[model samples]
Target chain A: MESHIELSFEDIRGKQHATLIHFIGDLDATNIELVLEKVFNLINEGTVNIIADFKQLRYVNSTGLGILLHFSKTAREKGGCFKIANINENVYEIIEIIGATTLLEIYDDVDEATAALT
Target chain B: MTTQRMEIDIQEVPESEGVVILHFSGDLTSECVRRINECFSAVGKKGKTYAIANMAEVTLISSAVLGEFMGCRKRLIEEHGDLVFCGLDLEMRTKLHLMGATKIFRIYTDIRTALNSYKWEIERQPEKFHVSFPPYLKIVPPLRQLVSRIARQKGYGNRDSFRIETIVDEICNNAVEHGRPKADDLIDLTVIIDPDKIEIDVRNMSDPDKVASLTAMLLPEKTDTDKPKPDVKRGRGLSLIKMLSDGMSVECTDRGTSVRVKKVREE
Candidate 1:
C-alpha cells in the first residue's frame, strides 16, 4: 500500500517567471514534504508565479491543503502568485469548508488563471 | 496511598443531532471537579445542548461534581440544550434522588432510550468495516479509497463520499505523524455506514500529551476560534475533520486515543 504523488511542470509560453504544475495522485501527509520541496525549489529558482492544475488530482487532505496555502503565501511574498484552476468539485468542497477559497486564488480554468497572472 | 482518579470518556451519541454522552468511571469527587468541568464544558463548547451522563461504572460520587453537573445542565437549558443521566445503578439513583438533583435532570435507565428521547432514530443493521495495519503513511491512501468506496455503495453522494475519505485520510495521517507509533504499533480503523450517515472510528497508540494536543485541536477551546487561520502550515488536519463532519468526539486514555466522526448523507 504505497501512496504516490507526481508533479509535472510546464512553462507558460510568454510569461517570464510563471510555471504551471499538474498534480497527479493523492496529496497527503505522507508525500507533502516532497511537494513542498519541489515548489520551494521552483520558487528559489525565480519561478514564483505558479498555477496548479488539479484536474488530475484524485485526492488531497488538510496536509495537502496546508502546503497549497503555504505556496500561495510564499509566492506572494516573493512578488509572485500561486493560483489554482480546474479544481474538481470534491476538492473544492474541502477547500471551501476549510474556508480557504478566499485565501488562495482560484479560477475555473487554467487559461483564466494564466491570463490573470501579472 | 494513591487515590484512583476518575476517567472521563466523551462520545457523540449516534444520530442525536448536537448531543453527546459523557461516561464517567471510578469515584468522581471534589478532586476530579476540574477534569469533570472541562469535559462537561467542552461538550457545551462544541455547540451541543444535550448530554447523557452514563454513570454505570461510577462507584462513588461527591457533591462538588454534582454541583458542576447541575451548573452544566442549567447552561444547556439556557441554550435550549440539556443534560441527562443513564445506566445509573440503584445506589447512584438514590444519591441523585436524595440530593433533589433528580428533579433537575432527566434520568433514563440506559443510553438507548435516552437517545430516543431526543428523537434520534437508531440505525438497524448498519454496515460495518474494520481494518488494522501498522501506522504507516502508505497505508492511508488505499484505506481511504476503500472507505470512500464503501460510502458510495452505501448511498453517499460523491460530495459526501469525498468528505468521508477526507476525514479518514486526515485522521489516519494525523495518527501516524503525531502518534509516532513504534514499528510494532498498529492503527485500527472502523467505519459504520448507516442508511442516513457514515460513522468512523480510528484508534492509534498515543501518549497523553499527544492526545491532549489533538483534543485541543479537534475541538477548539472556544467556538469563536474554531476555524484555524489559513496561514499556518501545520496543525490543520484535525480542524478540517472537525469542520467537515456532522458530529465528532475524541476519547483519550493513558493507553491510546480514539477519534469518532460522523457525516450525514446529503439529500
Candidate 2:
C-alpha cells in the first residue's frame, strides 16, 4: 500500500532561488522514492536552494529522516542549501532523538527559513 | 538434471540446540548417496538428530538417494527425533508423492514453517504479547501505533508512549532496511509491558553476512570526533533507538537477528 504523503512546490524569488516543498502527510519508506525524485528534480533544474516546510507533516520514520538529510547534503553539493521550517513537535522530537538537529538546517518557520536561504 | 554434482552445507540452528539445517543443492544421484549418508551419520554422531533437509536447489534425485533419505528419517525417528523436509519444489513434491513417501514425511514450504513445527512452547505471560508480519515498511506504522497504545493503556505518560513508539519505529525500520529478508521471511515483534518499564524485541531472519554488517553499524566503536558529519544521511536509526530506549541489546545468529530495547516511564 502507498503511504499518504503529498508534496507541493512553491518558488520563492529572493536572495537565492529556492523552492519551498510542503509535506502534507506522513513521510515514510512507501513514499520516499517519490519525494527523493521530486527533490532531485528540483536540484537538477537549478533549484538547489530548497526549503522543506514540515508544518503539515504529521509523522516521519527513520527512512523519511534519512531522505531529509540526503536532500540537505545533495542541495548543498550543488552550491545551494536545504532548510527545514515549521516542524511539529512529534517530528522534531524524532530528529532530536537521532541527534540530527544540528546536521540539517532547521528554522522556526517559513519566514525564518526563507530569510536565511542562501 | 543440470549439474551432476551435489553440494551439501550444514549449519546448526542457533538457540535451537540439537537442530541442524542441511542445505542441499544440485543433482542427488547414486554417486552422492554415500556422501549424503555420511553427512547424516556425522550429524547424528554430533547428537543433532532434529534435521531439516532444505532441497530448494536440488534439480534431480536418484532412487538410491531417496532411499537414503527415508533410512535417515527412520533412524532419527527411532531415536525419538525426526527429520523434516522444506523448500521442496513442485517436481520434488511430485517425485515424493509418486513414490508414496509424502505420506510418511512432514514437508513444509520454507524453513520458517519447518522451524515452527517444532511447537516450542513460548511463555505467554499476562503482560506480554507477540506479533509477526511480513517484512514490509507499510506494516510498520500500525505496529508502532499498537505499541504506543499499549504503553498508554499501561499508564505510561504521553511522552513515554511516544518514546516507545519511536523505539519500535527505528528498530523495525532497521530490520527492513538491513535485514535483507526474503519475501517469505517474517519479522517478529514481542512486547512485554510492566508498570514502570517496557521491553520490546524485534527479530527478523537475515543471513550471517548482513547480520555482521548490521552489528558493526549499530554498535560502532567510534568516538565523538569520528562521528558522521553534519551532512550524513544514514547511520542514524540505530543511534535514535539507543538514545530513546533506556537499555538495548542486539543478538545476531546464523538464522536471524534480534534487537531488544527497554524503556522506562518518566514521572
What's the residue-level lDDT of B64 in candidate 1? 92
Computed on alpha carbons, the lDDT of every model, listed in order, comes to 0.84, 0.82
Name the 10 consecutive residues with the lowest summed lDDT in model 2 chain A: A11-20
Displacement of residue A73 (Cα, Å) in model 2 is 1.9
Chain B TM, every candidate = 0.51, 0.50
Q: Which digits, one per residue and each the tens of the lDDT, describe model 2 over residues A23-108? A: 99888767889888888888888888888999999888777898988888888788889999999887899888767888889999
Rate residue A116 of model 1 by lDDT.
97
- Tell me the tens digit of each residue's lDDT in model 1 across B1-267: 555579988898656658888888988879998888788777888888888889989887899989988888888889877888999999889988999988888899998878766653332346677998888888898899899897777667888888888989988888887675587888889998777888899888887788887677655464626666677877777777878888888898655788899988885
Evaluating just chain A, the predictions reach TM-scores of: 0.97, 0.95
Clashing residue pairs for model 1: B49-B82
Question: Where is model 2 more than 4 Å wrong at Cα?
Answer: A13-16, B1-126, B216-232, B252-255
